[model samples]
Every structure is written in C-alpha cells, then in structure tokens.
Target chain A: MEFTTSQVIEILGTIAFAISGSFSAIQRRLDPFGVLIIAFVTSIGGGTVRDLLLGDTPVKWMRDVNYCLLILVTSLLTIVLKRHRKRFTVTLFLFDSMGLGLFTILGIQKGIAFGLSPGICIALGTITGCFGGVIRDTLLNTIPLIFKKEIYATACILGGILYFTLLFFNLKADVAKVLVIGFIFALRVVVVRYKLSLPRFGY
Target chain B: MEFTTSQVIEILGTIAFAISGSFSAIQRRLDPFGVLIIAFVTSIGGGTVRDLLLGDTPVKWMRDVNYCLLILVTSLLTIVLKRHRKRFTVTLFLFDSMGLGLFTILGIQKGIAFGLSPGICIALGTITGCFGGVIRDTLLNTIPLIFKKEIYATACILGGILYFTLLFFNLKADVAKVLVIGFIFALRVVVVRYKLSLPRFGY
Candidate 1:
C-alpha cells in the first residue's frame, strides 16, 4: 500500500508534463477540451508508448485512475495560475527537468525488467523521456524541440549509459537510480543555462 | 501456411503506408537514412501503438522480420520510381486509400480482441488508419492531412461503425471487413474527387 520512491517520481513527472502541456494549450489559445486532451497526452504519451512496446497493456494510467486525476488537477491548476505565468515559468523548468530525468531512469528500468538488450534499453529510455514532447509538439503543429537541438534525448541516453555502467559494476539499484537521475537533471540544467544544443542538420 | 484474406490485406496496407512515408521523406529531400526511418515508422507506427494500448507486446513488426524487409523493399522501390514521379501520384493515392482501409479494420479487430468497448474500438480503428500519416507529416514538418479539411479520419470512423453494425447483425466476418474497407476507400476517393472537406475551425 506504500508508494515507492520510484512511484512518487512517476507521479510528480506526470504532473509536471501535464502542466507543461496545459501551458502549451493556453499559449495556442486552444478550446478547453483541446487543452485537456493535450495535457493528458503529454503527461502519459511516453509511458503509454513504452508500455505498449513492452506488451504491457491496459496501460499504467488505465490501471490507476489516480494518474488521470493527477493530470486533470495539474492542468486545472495551470488555468488558475495563468495570471502569474511568469512565476510559473521557473516552476515549469524545474518540473520539466525532473520529469525528464525520472522518466528516463524509469524507462531504462522497465526495459531492463523486460530483459531487453542494452542498446534497445537505451533507446527505450530516450523514447520514454522525450516522445511525449514530440507528440505534444506534433499536435501543436510545431517542430519538436528535442528533434531540433534541445540536448534533451541526449541527456537521457547518457544517463541510461551511466545507469547500466553502474549496474555493471554491481552498484546498489537505488544508488544507481539516484545517480543516473541526478546526472540527467544536471546535464539538462547546464545545457539550457549555457544555451548548448546539437548542431542542426540542414537538408 | 496459407495467408488469410485479412492477413493479405494487412501486408498490402503496410507496404502501401511504407511507400507513402518514403514518398513524403523524398519530397522533403531527407537523406537516405531519414527516408528509411520514415518509411519504417509509418508502416509500423500505428499498429505498434494499437498493440501497446491493447497490452500486446514485442509488437507485430518485431515478431515478424518480414515487415521490416517489406518496408525496406518498398522504400527502395520509391527511390527507383522517383524519376517517374509524375506517373506515381495516382498510384500513391490508391495505395494510401488501401492502407487506410486495411489498417482501420485491423485496428478495430485488435481492439475487439482486447475486449474494449465498441466506441473505443472505432477510435482504435481511426487511430490505426490515421496516426501513421500524422507521424509522417509531423516528421516532415507539415500539418497532418487528417487534421486539415481532409475527410481522412472521418471515413475511417464511418467505416468502423459500419463494420461493427454488420457484425452486430451476425454478418460473416470476411464480408463485413471487405464491405467496411470498401466503404472507407470509396468515401476517400469521392471526397477527394469532389474537393469536399470539413469546415476549418478558427480560434
């Protein structure tokens, strides 16, 4: 009945992603239903994809109504806090970074649990960390930030490698998880702060 | 083992979708790798999503290497036909319609297999028919055809309803499927020919 640390991270990440999605919808001046749909998809799209690829159906959100409620509540909060949008920008960045880090590790862990190859696990981790944004951006009719030059998926991949490396050396699972998450979080913060990005590929 | 009519339709649909994806990539002037990736994802993305939501894992393409080979071959064919591109527009439209029809029924059947509600089944069918194009258009940095005035998803939904209605009346499965697929295909052809489209929604 007790929520594990990992579970707590997942919940927090879902809320963060949902808020970001709602923020995007508001920015785009979408209708209320559109805003809610965007928030729901952004919050759960990546995990839903990972679960589907892993053949784990009925999906996580469907299994627990709490996650849906959490997303709904987070999205509603965005509407209330719209007037103080500038203040929420800092909160958005923090939550987004935390979501990216936690989701990356969670994805890698799920891949490992499924007994997938290391390469596939890393890919899965990256997909889990970034695909929701891709879906969100696609729906919003903008180029996905990650695909452009955000250094987002890169951090997830690096963290995934670090995670497996630590596990290879027989490090404790919790310690490895914390370190990997920290690495991804720090990497993203540093990248954004310095305006570092991958070089754009020209056609 | 001999392939059933449904299985054949599915294979043809995959090939058709792959060609459409490759065509989009080529038009966008993507590199060879990008073209291949687009083709592969477009061919398999929808079903992969449907499977994931249904909790069926290892995904269909991964379990069957033939699909990958099919996509690869289809993409290569596109490259060859590129020089004769003017002759291929009609071909593209036909293949695209066939893909839409096949994937719609396939998705609905999968949803039914998973014991989902009728409404969810129709939604699954529409997603299966339309999401690949969504992903392809997103990757190509264009608005998805379905989201525009195109009668894309609408046709799928209508066909799906017909499919279920026929089944509800205890129609033979193969007959119902063929009728549904034909309905979608014909609807698309008619809508495109008549330049009929849904009214655009403005914020």
Candidate 2:
C-alpha cells in the first residue's frame, strides 16, 4: 500500500491528537502509564473506531509500531511538561484542529474505499474526526467538546461534503484533501476566535 | 442461517451486559440520558467490538432496533429501581458473566468466519468480551477492572479455547456452547465466591 503524503499527514495528526490526550491525563494527575493509555486512545481512538466500522482488523496502531511509539514519546513529553499544561491547551487545540481535518478526509477516503455511499462516508469522516476527543473528555469526566464548544466536528462534516462535492467536479484527490483540510481549519479558527458554539440538546 | 444455541446465549449475554452497565451508571448518579448511553454501550459494546474487528459496518445495534430497545428498557428499569442498585450488582454480575462467555464464543466464531486461525480467534474473543467494560470504566474515570480484581475477562478466553477444542472433536455446536458457557459461568462463580485475585504489578 502506498503511504501517500496525505497518509503521512494523517499520522502526524494522530500524533498531535495523542499529545492533546496526554496533556489532559497529566492535568488529571494520572501516572505515566495512565498518561500513555490516554494519549494512545485519544490519538487513534477515532481511527480505530473507523477501522472497526470498516471491519479492518489489527487496527492501524496495532499494525504500525510508529503510532505506538508516537504516543509513548508524547506521554513522556507530557510528564516532563506537567508544569506547563494550562498554557499548552491552546497550542494543543491548534494541532487537534489540524488532526480533526486530516482524519476526517482519511475516514471519508476509507469509507469510499469500502464502497459505502457518500452520505455514510461523510458521517464516518465526522465520527473519525471527533470521536477520539469525545472518548478523551469522557474518560477525563468532562463534557465532550464536540457536544459543547466550537465548530469542530461539524466543520469536518462540511469539509467532507466539500471533498465529495469537489470530487464530483473531477477535482484531483490531492487537491480535494487540501481543500477539505483548509475548509476545516479555517472554520475552526473562525469559530474559536469568535467564541461561536453549537446549539445543545440535553436529550 | 442457523441460530445456534450459542447465538441464543449470546443474546442473553448482551442483555446482561446492558443491565450491568445501567446499574453501574445509577451508582454514579447519572442523569437519564447518561443511563441510556451507559446501558446501550454495555449491552452492545462487546458485540460492536467484535463486529468492528471483523470489519463489519453499522456495528450491531445500528442494524437491529431491538438492541436499542432492550438497552432502553434496562435503563428505564434502573431509573425506577435506583434505590436498589447495590442489591442488583449480584444479578448484574451473573448476566455479565453469561454475556462474557457468549460474546467470547461469538468473537471466536466471527474470527473463524474471517478465516483467522485459533490463536487470533481466542484473542479476538477475549478482546470483544472485555473491552466494553474497559470502555465503561474509562468513561467513568476509574481504573479498569483489568488493573484491578477480576478472575479474568476470565471465562470468555477459556470458553473460546474450549469451543475450538470441542470443535476439534466435531461435537455438536449447541452441545459445545452449553459446555463452554457452563464451565465459564461456574469458574466465574467460584472466583467471585472465593474472592480470587491476580498477581498485581507494582507501579
């Protein structure tokens, strides 16, 4: 299988996600192993969910040693930087938004590969981009950001739609990925900067 | 298209997992929506896990409305009987153990269908049968049962191996399921009764 540039970006996005998760665990006063687990889960959890949805076995992380090492290194870095967590949240969120955008496209691409309809692919993309954070927040006993603040996961959905919509116009795959990621990142930036929010329902 | 006796037991087990999860959520004083999420996840989590491993789509609950309704009923029951949660833990454990054994077999069966060899099948079975509880605990911000006292994901792995071993002798599938569930359930009972413990790793 070709590890395209987009796939490489996807891995970096995963690493960034792991950092976000590890920082959360560190703030909660968890031990190093606990930190690593949180990092590992938060980074790859969504992709793992997507893979499972597509019936891919051994998961990407389980198949690739690099993902595991990324989480471990991030965890160690988290422990070393425990004193600076509050200041890191904003920095982490930036990386996370990038991850969100990238994973969304990756998930959509996988769904397409598995022959799912475009509608399902977009939903898969949204889930892939957001579910890891949901799992992380839930584990930390906080309300998930996806359900609360920012235009995060929703941006991913819109971008994925744009991806397929652009593809229908016969846009190149590389260009489609760039356009979707750009859309998500910009949407997230505008939402965060303006303090925008999604409407919440208790049910 | 045979609904093997094992399949029947697996359904019952799913119900058990749902009950346990709902009850646990009550002990945590979750709201109604929280209860439903917990119950639904508990019931379908393992099977959903197994299906994901097999690269199945829509997970299991998304396909069948009954699974959702069953979990809904359990959550409703929990809301009604919130006062008696401690008393219900025993009943929940009984079902959980049954669910554990049945899901284990289901996982192994799915693995075999995927043409996996016995070793991976057992591992998949063990993961399917246990990961849900791990997830539930992680969501609750508690250390998982895997790190604490439990006889095992215990019965599932043993029963998985037993099922494949029995198949080596070409025993009837129904008879094998009964034997495996019975043995696993008995082992669980004995373990709980004696307060059995695994050797702990020092942190």
Candidate 3:
C-alpha cells in the first residue's frame, strides 16, 4: 500500500516507541507478557491521550488493529535483537528520541487540524511526545525522565513553535515537518549529552 | 436542579475521589497546587479513559466545566478539613472505596448504553473503578493498593457481575444499582478488615 508522509512518520514513531519500551521493560527484568504490555502502552500512549483530548474518539489504536499488530511484531523483534546486542541504554535513548520528535510533530499537526490555539497545540504536542515515556517509567516505578530531564518537553514545545514559524515563512509543509522533527531529536541529544537540566526547587 | 441518580452518583464519586486524592497529596507534602492537580486526575482519570474507549467525545471534564469547578472546590475543602482532623488515612480509604463503587456502576451502565457485551462492560466497569486510584498511587510513587491488595479490581468485576445478574433476575434497576454499589463498598471494607490478599508470584 502506498503510504503518505504522515503515515510513514506515524509507523516509524510507533516502532521506535515499541522498541524503547521493550528495552526499558527488559532492563527491569519483566516477563515477556509484561514487556509486551509495556510496549503496547508506550507505543499507543501518546496518541491515545492526544486523540482523547481532541475529542477524537475510539482512539487511534482501538480503531486501527494494524498498529496493535505492528507494536506486537516490533516488540518481539526487540526481544530477539536483545540477544545479539550488548548496549541497550544508548540504543533505547536513540529510538526514544526519534519517537519523541516524530510523535511531537504529528501531535502538533493534529492539534492544528483540530483548530486548537497555538499554546494548546504546543501543549498537546509535548503531551503526545512525553506521556508515553512518562506512563512507562511510572509503571516501572521509576522517576519519569521528563521529571529528571528538563529539556524533554521543552524540545517538543520549541520544535512546535519552529514548525509554526516555518509555516508562516512559506516553508513547504513536508520540509517544515522534517526540520521540526530533526530539531527536536537533535535538541534532546545535545541536552542529554551535556547533562543539562533545570534547577530543582523544593516545594 | 433535579439530578438524576446517575448524575448524583457521578458527582459523589467525583467528590470522593477529589478528597481521596487531596489526602494522598497532602500526606506526601505536595504543595496546594500539586494537591489540586492530583485531585483532578483522581476524579477524572477513569471517566476520561472510558469516554475515549467508547468514542464519547470531549471526555467528561472538558465538556463540563462544572466538574472542574467541583473538583477544585472539593480539593480546597479537603485541605481545609485536614487542619481540623488528625486522622486522614481512614477517611481517605473510605472515600476511595466509595468512589470505586460509584464509578464501577456508572461505567457498566455506560457500556450497556453503548450496546457492549457483558464481558466488555465488566472490563469497562473495572477500569473505570480502579484506574483513577491506580494513576494516583503511581504518581505518588507508591505501590498501588490494587497490586498489593488484589481486591480492588476484583470487587469492581464481581460487583459488575452482580449488577447484571440482578437485572437478569428481574430486580428493579435502581435497586440493583444501589445493591451493587453497596456490595462493592462493603466487600472492600470486609476484605480490608480481614486482611485478605491474593498470593503474589515473582515475575
């Protein structure tokens, strides 16, 4: 089947999150069923939240069994790949970053399509980008990476703004999407590499 | 305003969860803002998930600003009430149990309204009853009582079954609803009183 650019991005983001979730679950030594459950949650978590907030019902995954099949296959592949791979942390981080960028852009576009305000769109984008990881980490009893890494949602928000700016400047929509995704992915990498974080405040 | 039974149950459940969440957040020493946020999540989390699954748009809280106002007021009331009371744990537990019963019945009725199968309706009921506390406990970084106690979702499931059975037996709808809710609430209390728990297996 011929796929649109948006569809391709969605598939890639889903796969990336599935693999990332598998790695986290495996690291926690969860059983296979637990790993698959986590993978499903991570892969669909963001989109589900975005769709629900937009009042788009039946959720994406519930309506599309294909996504469920894809996540299952990807998770199984991740398990097989783990046997041959020694470095999980770095690989997990890379796929998660890619998923974050891709999902964030998609969420922003969805918000725009829904006729929401720019601020609400950015919030939606950030939520779609970060909530999967947040839920996954929370389920695994770890501090969510968003709480530890300040730049996580910031990257999505800034990338969202950039997308709107690019659109305003007459950039091709396709080109703008790619640029925004690359911007978010690169921003996350740079921040993590430098261990950059916002200052902590006591409540 | 003439409130229907279902609306009354929804309001009571919302208030119960709001108070329960406030007590939890306060016990954790979170700021007032944090308490309000948790309260909102605990009250609306299950309903939001249910709405998304059933293709009910705008979810509950987003469409009805009154619910948000209710939760905010309830949370603030909880905070004020805390100053005059030294025993919060029991109160929190009681309210949580009541919320669980109320939400489970509401979810089952929604599922029935949607023409879902009995099994699916039961699952919806369980999810609607338990997910709020699950999210709340996860956010608080504590082991969810559902996982530890095992009776949480079980009560919802059994209660759901009882509701269906009563209807099948020609019991009045309103009477059945009240009976099921009371059964769930009382079951929880009895199980906790007896320290009943399912056996845990290492995964």
Best by TM-score: 3
Give the count of colliding residue pairs in each prediction. Answer: 3, 2, 0
For model 1, what is the error of residue A115's alpha carbon versus the real structure, in angstroms, after optimal superposition? 17
Tens digits of per-residue lDDT for model 2, A65-104: 5666677787677566556445766766786787788889
| Local lDDT at B59 for model 3 | 68
DockQ of 3: 0.15
- Candidate 2: tens digits of C-alpha lDDT, residues B18-123: 8778877776778879978888777777777767655677677888887688778867876786675457768757766776776777777777777766766776
Return the candidate ranking by TM-score, descending.
3, 1, 2
lDDT of each: 0.82, 0.76, 0.87
Which prediction has more favorable DockQ, 1 or 3?
1
Please list all clashing residue pairs in model 2, or write none if there are none. Answer: A55-B55, B13-B99
Runs with alpha carbons beyond 4 Å of true place in candidate 2? A1-3, A81-83, A168-170, A198-203, B1-51, B54-203
Of the candidates numbered 1 and 2, which has the greater DockQ value?
A: 1
- What tens-digit string does per-residue lDDT give for candidate 3 at A7-81? 999999999999999999999999999999999999899998888777786788989899999999999999987
Cα lDDT for residue A63, candidate 1: 57
Give candidates' CA RMSD values in order. Answer: 7.0, 7.8, 6.8
DockQ-based CAPRI category assigned to the predicted complex of candidate 3: incorrect
Off by over 4 Å in 3: A1-48, A52-126, A132-141, A145-203, B84-86, B197-203
In candidate 2 chain A, where is summed lDDT lowest over 10 consecutive residues?
A28-37
Per-residue lDDT of B101-173 in model 1, one digit per residue for the tens?
A: 9999999887787776776778688878888888888778887766555578778878998998999999999
